[model samples]
Target: MKTAEYEIVRDFAAQREQVYAAWTRPERFARWFGPRMFTTPADRVVLDVRPGGAWQATLVGEEGFEVTLRGVYREIAGPGRLVFTTGDPDSPGDGPASVATLTLEECEGGTTMRFHQFGVNTDAEHAEQARAGWLEFFDRLAEHLAVQATSSKVSARP
Candidate 1:
């Protein structure tokens, strides 16, 4: 039933340091990474950003309700690569965990980063939906990365 794998490659004219920071830091994580389809909590984010660390996020439901996502980081290859699961409670079992991989490569202008989500086939419709969802998310990410770069430089200026 699971039958969806997708890859989105985006190269930013932003600085690599800023791009790397946005992906690794939890503060930056909340700004860009999320469904963003509904009203999401910008402050309710906790990502350890390391192997064996926890990644938690909570979104308030209608009329004071809250939904949670609990998972752990499975792999970390420094600034170049990162692999983790979003909803894997026990992580690395028979059940497929959503695998998120980010790769950063330097380019002539700035940096080329590829975002890949490889597992999402629980159902035919779900797989298709995920593909569409990731495409939208990547678009958001591109904008966020650029802003992050500009903000960092402005803050660094004395």
Candidate 2:
């Protein structure tokens, strides 16, 4: 069976640890895990966040549809890199699960994140949609990080 893949490179105005925490911390992840019109509640997100550990998240759409994604962590190098396999448990026999890798590099001002996902069980068009969805998710992440930064600054005022 044919498969599709995509890679996205983005730079965030936050430290590598801050960006990495957004993915590993369940509370932070819940704030930006899904696309627009979808919410992933904190209680529904589980992140074991270690090699061989399992993680799962359920995003509920505005219209009440739910998408539950489950995965196992293949590698976890905190604040640097992460590798995992993700798939929808509801869809059995769709194809092989996709493997996703997130690499974070600390630059002069912030962090550069390289995200890649492969082995998607779909055509190019669907793969494009998936890529778009991930972009949306990242946009939300940026917004969340900005808010966190602002809050941290305000709290630091003495």
Maximum-TM-score candidate: 2
Write candidate 1's Cα lDDT for 1-158 as tens digits: 25356777888887667677776676776666655653345578787888989878776656877777657778888777777776662443555457778888889888888877766434556656776766766677778887877887899999
**Clashing pairs for predicted structure model 2, backbone only:** none
Tell me the TM-score of each prediction against the true structure.
Answer: 0.77, 0.92
Worst 10 residues of 1 by lDDT: 88-97
Among these predicted structures, which one has the highest lDDT? 2
| Whole-model alpha-carbon lDDT for candidate 2 | 0.88
Q: Model-by-model lDDT, in order? A: 0.70, 0.88
lDDT per residue (tens digit) for residues 51-123 in model 2: 9899999999867899898888999998899998887322527654678999999998889999998855667
Position 48, candidate 1: lDDT: 86
For candidate 2, the 10 contiguous residues with the lowest summed lDDT are 88-97
lDDT of 2 at 82: 100
